[model samples]
Target: MGLLSNRQRSNLIKSYLYILPAFLFLLIFTYYPIFYAIFISFFRWSTDYPQKVFAGVQNYVEILKGDLFWKVAWNTLLYSVSTIFISMALGLFLAVQINKKVRASGVFKVALFYPMMIPLAAAALIWLWIYIPTYGLLDHLLSGLGLPTLPWLNSTETALWCIVAVGVWKHVGYYMILFLAGLYNVPSELLDAATVEGAGGFHRFWRITFPLLSSYTFFVFIINIVDSLQSIDLVYIMTQGRPADATNLMVYYIYQQAFRYWNMGVGSTLTSMLTIFLLICVAVIFSTIGRRIYYEV
Candidate 1:
């Protein structure tokens, strides 16, 4: 019936003290900017503004009316879907190969995981050099085989895809390591039981191993979705959304609107839209995969 005892109060105070710095950090660096973005999105806030005019949903309406918006939206969707699915599959294949306890697995793991250690801009630059048309590495190889060479980053049809391939290359290693860890944790007893039941390799994988990696797959899915949505550095460095906006993506579109064009209101609206879209995607992912996760405990 009374207030907390002295020891309980002291413990509570200590817990609060331990968490206070992290909570404050998130408030300043993460939460505040999101709220501020939403605030400015509703108004005609510009670099010249000391005071702003309220615009409601006009920015959203205008963006919806534009043909370019939909073009860029389709571009973004295509790139994201293609990059994530292909990269994840490649990663899974590599992980399974390496997990076979083959000779020199340590070396193989390092080779596969090394790409993630490189910065994205640096990787993009390297791919840029590789993608140059006639004198580049790709064309050089094609020439060796007596095959005709095609424009890579120079053509609209291939520029976006070239960048997407670079993305898959850069991220596949990281996802491979994640899948490798999942494979390592797959219960030995379950595999043994499946083996004793005369289950072949494909059957064991489909019935046992793959389902056990559901959590890892879910994590990879979310990470790839976010990566795909926020991906701009590669596109910026490689193609700059050029060749008639063939590579235009939503995040880079927001960047161009906000910084290059100095249209803060529209930029903020685009930001809000991207946020909403990603949230919906996350919800859908959870709905599809949430209850299927099997904890090892």
Candidate 2:
């Protein structure tokens, strides 16, 4: 039985039509590729289909057995952990400082946020020049101070750290914005009450503000980890996993396996592994640290 009038049915259809394009776009581009990658992981694909040789779990075995896989896995974790902690520390510091009422606060915000707007490739190029031997900014300063000018991006020991610094610098601003928003949400009454109790700045921040900001901190932590895991552009542009693969990350390694070396099956296996790894990480985070966060007043 047709119960609804023509106008009501038309509005309902239009609402569904509005969301249909976005639904289809994600289905085709994101979901399909993910599922297909998992499907191909069990085969020996060489960038061609139908002729792909079936090799169940062998690609996973090969990638895990290879020394390169473990090396990049460690590098990925190192980069992610280093960048996330440093960036969050800097971001939280900046957010707290900037949240105070000051004359030049707007200018400081803009200056800090500017770096995040720069394209990663472009930023890598600029940093490449800065890290250039002898005449570069860093080495020039070191030389001027009569200190040893170490290789920035050339040495294995420092190459990953250099990239980590770049990542921290680029990402700290975005995280600062997130923390700033959370800071604003901290209850003014609570702070005022703490103030009346003769609570000092550090006491108030540690006891009240930081606890309220746990949600934002958790979000920034997860995002930084995920982004670092998928970091490829800067590595591709700056290091290309050079200096003995010190800066090699998992995503770049996957790209190399799939495109450069044309090991499609191995690439697919890596892709699946990365997905599962991220899922497990997220689950563990929610089960552990996420339980401590308070979202409600």
Candidate 3:
């Protein structure tokens, strides 16, 4: 091909210029911090040690040797698994229910999605009140019904689960919207033919609708896992990884190490570990489940 004319060259430069700001943002804010954290992971940098004394994987070894790290890892896994399944299930259910010809469906949608509109910290505070032992709304309702009242967030057995509930509540509506969009995109012709063939509602949904929604389901599943893994706001505001560290997660552990304890090396090591784990998860998911997703051509 011939070289570009002056107008074409000018247009190409303008296009690059249009994208320059966003490129710089990603380079500085995203990529730079990742590399910086990796670089910091090698050193013994803390409040006690102002100078960066190279520790060379000693931080990683320290974290791996600690019992608290394993406890936090298990907690993170439990929270992620519970939140991912519950949120996706509830979201799919709500989307299907609201997709029907129900009256005032839009109002129901808004009511469910309202939690997402609220800031997460504000939502945590709301749940905090709701979980306040016998004086909270939840306990009050249980007591009115002659049921037992238990401390939700102040107990080790229930604290992490309570946070998982919050995670599900906060993000389920967003997932519902995604599933709803997918439902809309399912080919009407296929459903009509299935109906004409005497396929029951459940059968139609199982055979046609669900299969067509595979791509959306996969996307939502990946998003839920990532969100669960990264979530720390509720843990920070409500529990602070307390009640014997029952609600402690990887991200909060990193925060505690870096800020509360001023252990920069350990914090960076934890950050790198989390990032690597997330990458592996995405890679495994894409290689396995992603290949099986159904697409409408």
* Range of the 10 consecutive residues with the lowest summed lDDT in candidate 3: 1-10
lDDT of 1 by residue, 98-203 (tens): 9999999999989888888998888888888888898899998998899999889889888889978988988999999999999999989999999999999999
TM-score of 1: 0.94
Model 1: lDDT to the true structure:
0.89
Per-residue lDDT tens digits for candidate 3, residues 1-297, read: 159998999999999999999999999998899889999999999998999999998998999999999999999999999999999999999999999968999998998898999998899999999999999999999999999998999899998999999889999999999999999998889999999999999999999999899999999999888888998899999999999999999999999999999999999999999998999999999999999999762
* TM-score of predicted structure 2: 0.92
Residue 161 of candidate 3: its Cα lDDT? 90
Sorting all predicted structures by TM-score, with the top scorer first, yields 3, 1, 2
Candidate 3 achieves a global lDDT of 0.93
**lDDT of all predictions:** 0.89, 0.93, 0.93
Candidate 1 off by > 4 Å: 1-4, 47-51
In candidate 2, position 209 carries an lDDT of 98
* TM-score for each model: 0.94, 0.92, 0.94
Expressed as tens digits, the lDDT of each residue in 1-297 for candidate 2 is 299899999999999999999999999998999999999999998855537999999999988899999999999999988888899999999999999977799999999998999998899999999999899999999999999998999999999999999998898999999999999999899999999999999999999999999999999999988898899988999999998989899999999989998888989999999999999999999999999999975
